[model samples]
Target: MGIIGINRSPSCGVDITSKNDQEVAGEGVFIEILRKKLEKNISIDMVGIKVLEIEKALIDIQRLINTK
Candidate 1:
């Protein structure tokens, strides 16, 4: 399975985060830590999305589900 998180969150962001009052590209601290732990076992997908961007998020969710 994959993880879905807030795109602009500082703690739960996956692909985007709020750093120094600016949005930047990177996993949040929590997600980064989790990824490191999980990577030791098996690789999995992580995605970030904005609540207002439901359509795009849905596509990402579909892609994650379709990952083999």
Candidate 2:
């Protein structure tokens, strides 16, 4: 299974997360934990979903699904 998260969240964003009102490129808290917990499995994909970039997110999700 895969997981999708909001890209603008401070704790859940996967790529473009907000920090002090400024956007930064990095992983969020939950993602970090999940990664550490699921490091043994490489087939599970994780992606970030952006509100403004819905089309891109959809495409990414589709790709993830196709991989599985």
Candidate 3:
């Protein structure tokens, strides 16, 4: 598996690995912009072990989307 580092926060660094390397990937600002643009269409799936605060952030994002 190839590991790619993502700058999330000082507390929790992010990484993405692939069984096969051909899959496309991006992180941080790229992800944020992609997510914002994707809001009207679908959800993106992320697999990882997250810290408590990061999980909370995810929950907050879900809430914002759900409330909208």
The list of candidate 2 runs beyond 4 A from truth reads: 40-43
- Model 3 residue runs over 4 Å out of place are 1-27, 48-68
Candidate 1 structure quality by residue, lDDT tens digits, 1-68: 88999998999999899999899999889998999999999998988889999999999889988995
Top-lDDT candidate index: 1
Model 3: per-residue lDDT, tens digit, 1-68? 11222334322223322324332233444444555676678765433333455775566456545653
List the global CA lDDT of all models. Answer: 0.91, 0.82, 0.41
Q: Ten consecutive residues with minimal summed lDDT in candidate 3?
A: 1-10
**Clashing residue pairs, backbone N/CA/C < 3 A, model 3:** none
Q: For model 1, what is the C-alpha lDDT against the true structure?
A: 0.91
User: Backbone clash tally for model 2?
Assistant: 0
